[model samples]
Target: MTPIQALYYFVEARPTRTGPPNVGIGAILLIVAAAVFIAWVAWLWIAARPSSGGEETALNLQPYLSDDELETTKLNRVLRAAM
Candidate 1:
């Protein structure tokens, strides 16, 4: 009816802004993103695992010892006990 309304309608071509001009993004991109995220998380999880090696070294830390360090350790323990 008004000149400004007519001009606006003609310029806009559409009455209201369409949410989207057309459909949407394809599913492939979403799938790729999910795969990449999963792979990244898996790599981080694997890298975080402890890689402690040498069973003999681990056993040396225990109380049972056939080495000379055990005598000094026992003496220290006795001194602490005496104190």
Candidate 2:
């Protein structure tokens, strides 16, 4: 047989000296980097986005709760305190 054939046979027949390399950390790091990059791009895209034709300031969200809701909250707080 040719030298190349002998080498191939030896390599194929011999057992591998080392088991599969540990790539979990590298894969996790790669995923984390990709996520971070994606997040950064999304943040930049949102920041540089053009504003709609409207008021510059955003509306505040503040709706007062009903009396019954307040009373229920108070009762829950009291029960929590008792516990």
Overall lDDT per candidate, in order of appearance: 0.82, 0.86
Residue lDDT tens for model 1, 1-83: 89999998898896776586554566667888999999999999999998876546566576776567767888789989999
Name the top lDDT candidate. Answer: 2
Write model 2 residue lDDT over 1-71, tens digit each, in one string.
99999999999999775766667788989999999999999999999988886855445555567789878
Model 2, CA-based lDDT = 0.86
Give me the runs in candidate 1 sitting further than 4 Å from their true place.
Answer: 1-25, 55-83
Worst 10 residues of 2 by lDDT: 55-64
Provide TM-scores for the models: 0.34, 0.38
